[model samples]
Target chain A: MLKNITLGQYFPGNSLIHRIDARFKLILTALFIAMVFCAKTPAGYGLIAAFLIFVVADSRIPPRLILKSLRSILIFIVFTAVLNVFFTKGETVLFSWRFLTVSREGIVFAVSMVLRIVFLIVGTSMLTYTTSPILLTDAIEALFSPLKKLRFPVHELAMMMSIALRFIPTLIEETDKIMSAQKSRGADFESGNLFRRVKSFIPLLIPLFVSAFRRADELATAMESRCYRGGDGRTRYRVMRSAARDWVALGAAAALTAGVVVLRIFGL
Target chain B: MEILRAEHITHIYSPKTPFEQKALDDVSFSVSPGELVGVIGHTGSGKSTLISHFNGLLRPTSGKVFVEGEDIWAQPKQIRRFRFRVGLVFQFPEYQLFEETVEKDIAFGPKNMGLSAEETAERVREAARSVGLDESLLEKSPFELSGGQKRRVAIAGVIAMRPRLLVLDEPAAGLDPRGRDEIFDTVRAYLASGENAAVVVSHSMDDVARTASRIVVLDRGRVALEGSPAEVFSHRDVIESTGLRLPFVTRVMHRLRDRGFAADVSVRDLDEAADALLRLKGGGGRA
Candidate 1:
């Protein structure tokens, strides 16, 4: 039942976005998110929206999959929208009921807040969708290499990230198996009171933790047996390099940021 | 009478997605009371998927499963009851052990059935004895047991439920010879006591050859062959083509038959093969 999670899932493709360097994609996504918050007018939001729509289309990831990720945060989005709509003060009130006022500016703030969140999620999902987990962590390691001189274990952190990414599906599968095994023994995880339901999960959780610890120990031993001491003197089989298309993508991102800044200043 | 039946069951995983796969396609089988049925297939041949349907653990995409003449899915909420009636011991069941003591672990199923503590303990003790678990070890935590002991405790957990139809997926996998023998012997004794039935999913022909009253071979999500051990092993070409290995004794018998000894290649056990050779020699055939 946990299979529907698409948070870190990657879709294999040969699209232009998929071919961009992982480092560039990460930078572009950050820049896109910054531009989203900087926009101050309908036209500016529309501009950023149009650019995002194009990027989504160019990435070639199915719209249904991108929308699936939004399901997890739907409640948060609604909460943010409601808070912005009722709390923001304005001179022009749109409605008032029992001292609960909804102002015109409040409505605009809510709409913009919702749009920015949705856009931010979709824009960031595009990066994960286009780039494999290993490459994404490799990019993070490369971008954070300067911190290593300050004693930050950048490579180890990246290795941990990749390992965690690698096991998400495996652990999910193990959970499914354990759930079935327990169910066969007449352990009911569904159809109980709130307290009873929480209590029922005890059977499932104990086994899951045991298996996870077992896997971690085996992995550590396997790595040690292979003489894996540390990141020093180690070389990666696949190295990241930027190409012409990556440069063009980075240039487009910079232009988008600059354009959003200008639009915010000029109220376009 | 048929104890459990899957009628033209078809299971599709992740339907309506790019990753959709037809794990089982129009596969059908039935187990008679007191019958021991062995399900053999190559990996991805739908062996695991097929057994998951027996107890309503998996809902069929386009077919139905009946437990003793009633459609199991007729009342979805009551599927939990069917689990007690059709106990399943999954592969590597040892990993599912979590109870503080072996006795409590075995009594888990009975407790779920809401049985009284006295009755639950009785069932747990009986199951432990049947599985050859030492009575002294019942007080210890399952985590403190050896690998084989842990596996037996997990199996006993289901056996304590006293299901009419017990389904196991590779129960003897990853075990030493003695461990495998003890597990199968426990299952054999369980079936011998009454009209209870079992379906053991395995890839090991030797284990099935010595135990199963019938065999079902699956290939690419379809029932490729189904018959008694002798009847199924006789079709060597079909079995080999499906990527299933025949019992070592059966293979040796086949080689003897090829050498013009006029021996029966349908033998599934060492004793039967020896007897077949002795019979041929007594008839003055070439050794």
Candidate 2:
């Protein structure tokens, strides 16, 4: 059952998006997130939507995959929408009930909040879908290289994040194995009261935590045996370089920001 | 009566996705009561997947699993009951040990069956004894036990339920020879109780040949071979084609026969081969 999780999962593709430099894609993703939040007017949202659609189409990633990632945080999205719909007070009321109010402004606010969240998630997912975890971490370490002057452990932090991301699937698969093991022993994780169900998870959680620590210890030993002593003096085999396509991607991000800024300034 | 049967089982993993692959295809088998069936296959040959179907842990894309003549998936809700009837000890089952104490871990299954505390404790002690775990060690935490002890505890947890059909997926995997022998002995004794059957999934042909009465060979999700151990070992070429080999003794017997020595080539283990060779020697080396 845990296999359905698609969070941070990378899809292999040979499209322009996949070929673009990881550093450029990362920067554009952050810029896209900012532009989505800055979109307050219908024209701004329409522009962002168009750009996202164009990116999705060009990337060639299956739309179903993008939608699957959204499934994980769907509850959060619905909650935010409902909160905005029922609680945001406005001068123009659409419907009123005892202690519950739905206003025209509330409807717009709810729709915008949901749209912003959806766009933010899809935009970030596009970045991960196109870039492999190793490349993504390399790009992050390179982006943070400037902070080395501040005496920060930028490389170490990036290594840690990458390791964590790399093990997400492994840990998930382990969890599934442990769950099935416990299930075969007559541990019922489903069809129980809330309390009983929570109690049943003890069999699964303890073993998962134990195995995770064991894995971490093994990984540490394996690394140490290979003479890994932090990122100092470590040279990468693959160097990140900006290609012509990367420059075009940067320009596209700039154009998106400009569009959002123009729509805000014109009050469209 | 047949304790378990899988009919034309076909399991396609992540169907309709890029990861789509057939883990099992058109496989059928049955385990009768008191039979020890050893399932041997190369990695990813669907041995684990087929065993998972016996207890309804996995649903086949197109097939049916029957436990005690009733379709496990017919009701769906009562599939949990089949779990108690068909206990599956996963690969490296030591990782499944979770209860605070060894005693409690072994009792977990019976408790889940809603047995009274007295009955659960009795079953726990019996299960521990069956696995050769000392009564003195039951009070200690499972974490305090050695690796072999921990695995036995996990096995005892399932055995306490007294499942009519026990399915073990590489129970002796990642263990020393002594540890593997201990586990194999315990499982053999457990099946000797006359009320239960067993299906052991193993890559170790020697271990399976020594323990199981029947051997089922899976090659790429299909039943490549199935028969008594002697019968299956007789066809060493077919078994080896699936990236598996007959037990060492069986191979020795085959070589002896090929060398024109009057020897029975159907020996399953070292003891049987030794007896057959001694008999041939006593008979003046003639068949």
Candidate 3:
């Protein structure tokens, strides 16, 4: 079947990082990504790596599983690396073959770019790994509560977002099952031409969409029966709160960002 | 005559991951030819997992599955042939129906079996007739049909393949009593000829008693018991302790036997029980 599926890959644990507010995490991840671009040297990238390792360790998810997530993106890393390696111009060339020249700077540039991507995926994965989608949506809604003042349907938007997020795994599982079912019925997907491949997706996608909407209908009915009145004064099962640990984590992120900025200033 | 046999099969989901679960732990069973076997288990007892292995849809984590004494996984790429040999009607298979017309949907399986278009059409009609679907409905889109009709259409799709073995996961689930009876009626006729065998994975003891020649009870992914309906149903105390109820007629008959009456322990049908009661009443002059 369709392995390598990481949708809503929540890692349940009683760790400090897992207990942190997901909204803060989402924001901090954005800030951390922005800071990755600010790093100008190997030492600065080292800081980012250290920070990622610290966060990952604090989340308490086994390294083996996180490495499994990284495996799928290996091809993307190589693709990005090759693009950067071939595109970067430098006066110093390490090797030249035909029209292709491998530069010392280009190799370093590719390695750094690939490292950035690896960190980017792993860092974002932390949010999903620690927080379930429902709790994450509630935190997002609560964090963006001020948007309600601007006539934005914060609750409705969060509800829609949560529903969409929730269905990612469900739809993936459904697509996998339908694909296998069709495969058993001799709907060839692998040994087909480009046109045939696209055509093959018709059977999979149509059934997937049909089942998804069907599930949505059933879920809405279930929710209505349970009296799921939207975010209008409706309390959550688990309230979003920022505890002392959240401040500590945020403080560490701020410090890391400041250190990176200083390093960029020095170009060291 | 044993068409399907899973020897020492074990399956684990999300293995080595934090959420790892042993769905089927060393479960083994064999289905003899023309035998209607009922598989019953509590939720998460690996009943669904077990049926998936019958048709090579799933491979065991360890151990072997043989279809008619041939290793289904001998050539990994040839697993599709095994699927055609064993038709599996997955739970809620109706949701998998995507063809524009009922005829096309029913033809899907037979066509997948590499049958000629004419042969596929013939099977489509035959299967539809077997399930009591009208020929006029063949032109209608499967989605437009009622839920039970769509269910039968999905079932007909699999049956049209004419697999040597048929495995259905809860065929009569969510159906009205009449709809349930109609399904079992078709299954009974299909099994009457003893040309093929079918396995029904269900939790309803009464339904199993009414339809299956034998029952295979599963507890925690192990085959707790596998025997003819009468032999398995005789262990009412063990069945009850596993959170499974005995067949309705069997419970009634058991109570009568407790009262020093020679009520037949094999009576699982209402009519049969009624007939037995009448005979007992006449012999005892209680009429």
Candidate 4:
């Protein structure tokens, strides 16, 4: 049951989006997020939605999987929508009851807010679904290389992130094993009240934490024994290079953002 | 009466996904009381998946599991009761130890069964004693023990629940020879009551042959062979083709027979092999 997490999971493909340089994809995703927030007019939202749908189609990731990613945050989306619908005071009231009001403007605001969140999630997930975690971290390190001049440990931070990402599946498998072990001994994590259910996880969590620490320590030892000294004097085997497709993708994203800004400026 | 019975059980993992796999397929098996059933299969041959069904850990995609003539999954809400009846000690179970003290860890299972504090303590002590753990070591942290000792503690944790049928997956894996012998000995002692049964899953033919009263060979999710050690080991070609070797003693006896010595190639254990050799010597060594 713990295997359903699909957020930030990469799907390997050779589509145009997958082949684009990870650095460019990262920039494009940020630009898309910024543009989504700037979308105040219906025309701007429509443009953003069309661009997202196009990106999702071009990436070739299964629609079911993309929808599954959204399912994880469905509660957050519903909560925000409800908050905006009942709390945003407006001139035209659509519905009213004791201590609650839903106005025409409130409904519109809620729809736009939900759209913004959905677009933001889909846009960022497109980046992760196309680029492998290793390449994503590499892109982050490259994009933030300027921070090195400020004496920041960008390389170390990136290395840590890549390692953590690599171990997620391993730790998840370990948790499954440990959970089954506990369950076989009559540890009921499914039944009981909320407190009791959470209490049952003690047997599961302590062992999981212990195993995680043990794994981390062994990994560190293994790395040091193999003469792995941080990012100092490191050389790259797969250098990131911009291709024509990458340039075109970036230009399209920039143009989309500018168009949204222009539409907002014209009050469309 | 059969302690456990699996009827045409088939399990498919992640069904409909690209990673879909049939881990078990139309396998029917049963264990009578006072039987030590050894399940031998290469890795991913569905040995682990089969044992998980004994306790309702993994519901079969297309079959039923009965514990003592009652369908285990008949009442899904009460599945935890079957877990108490059929305890499972997982592979590398030592990693599951979490309580502060060995005593508490051993009592974890019995406590989960909702036994009184006194009964839990009694079972804990009995389990610790059965596993050859000292009373003095019970107070120390399980993490402070050696790998073999920690494994024993983990086993005791399950045994303390007093399951009628105990299933262990690769219980002696990665242990020294003596440690392996100790683990098998403990498991054998647990079945001395003549009212309990066990299914020891392992790839080591020698360990299973030494203890198992009956052997079941699984290959590609199907039951390839099932019989006593003598009956199963006689099919050397079938066993070898399944990517498993005969017991060490059986292989040695076969080699002796190949070398022109009139030895019983069906010998499944060291004692049988020794007795066969003595008879061969008495019969002038060659046919």
Stretches off by above 4 angstroms in model 4 are: A85-104, B249-263, B270-287
When just chain B is superposed on the true chain B, each candidate scores a TM-score of: 0.98, 0.96, 0.94, 0.97
For model 2, the DockQ equals 0.76
Best-fitting candidate, scored by DockQ: 1
The DockQ values of the predictions, listed in order, are 0.84, 0.76, 0.48, 0.78
* Candidate 3 per-residue lDDT over residues B9-91, each given as its tens digit: 99998898666889999988888778899999888789988998988778899989999899999998878888887888877
Q: Could you give candidate 1's per-residue lDDT for residues B1-287 as a string of tens digits?
A: 68898889999989999889999999989999889999999998999999999988899999999998989999988888899989999999999988899998898899999999999999999999989999999999999999999999999999999999988899999999999999999889989976999999998899999999999999999999999999999999999999998999999988888887788888878888889889988897774
**Which clashing pairs does model 4 show?**
none
Please provide, for model 1 over A1-268, each residue's C-alpha lDDT reduced to its tens digit, 9 standing for 90 to 100. 6776665789999999999999999999889988998998988899898998898898888888888889889999999999999999998988999868999999999999999999998888888899999999999999999998999999999999999999999999999999999999999998879999999898899999999999999999999999998788889898888999999989988998898899899988
**Candidate 1: TM-score?**
0.95
- How many residue pairs clash in all the candidates, one count each? 0, 0, 0, 0
lDDT, residue A60, model 3:
86
Against the unseen true structure, what C-alpha lDDT does each candidate score? 0.92, 0.91, 0.85, 0.93
> How many clashes show up in model 1?
0
Model 1 ranges off by over 4 Å: A94-98, B256-261, B281-287
In candidate 2, the residue pairs with backbone N, CA or C atoms under 3 Å apart (3 or more residues apart, or in different chains) clash, namely none
lDDT of 2 by residue, B1-287 (tens): 89999899999999999889999999999999889999999999999899989899999999999999999999988889999999999999999888889999998889989999999999999999999999999999999999999999999999999999988899988889999999988888987868889899999899898889899999999999999988988887898899987788888888888888888878777778889999998987744
Consecutive 10-residue window with the lowest summed lDDT within model 4 chain A? A1-10
What does TM-score give for chain A of every model?
A: 0.95, 0.88, 0.85, 0.93
* Order of the predicted models by DockQ, top scorer first: 1, 4, 2, 3
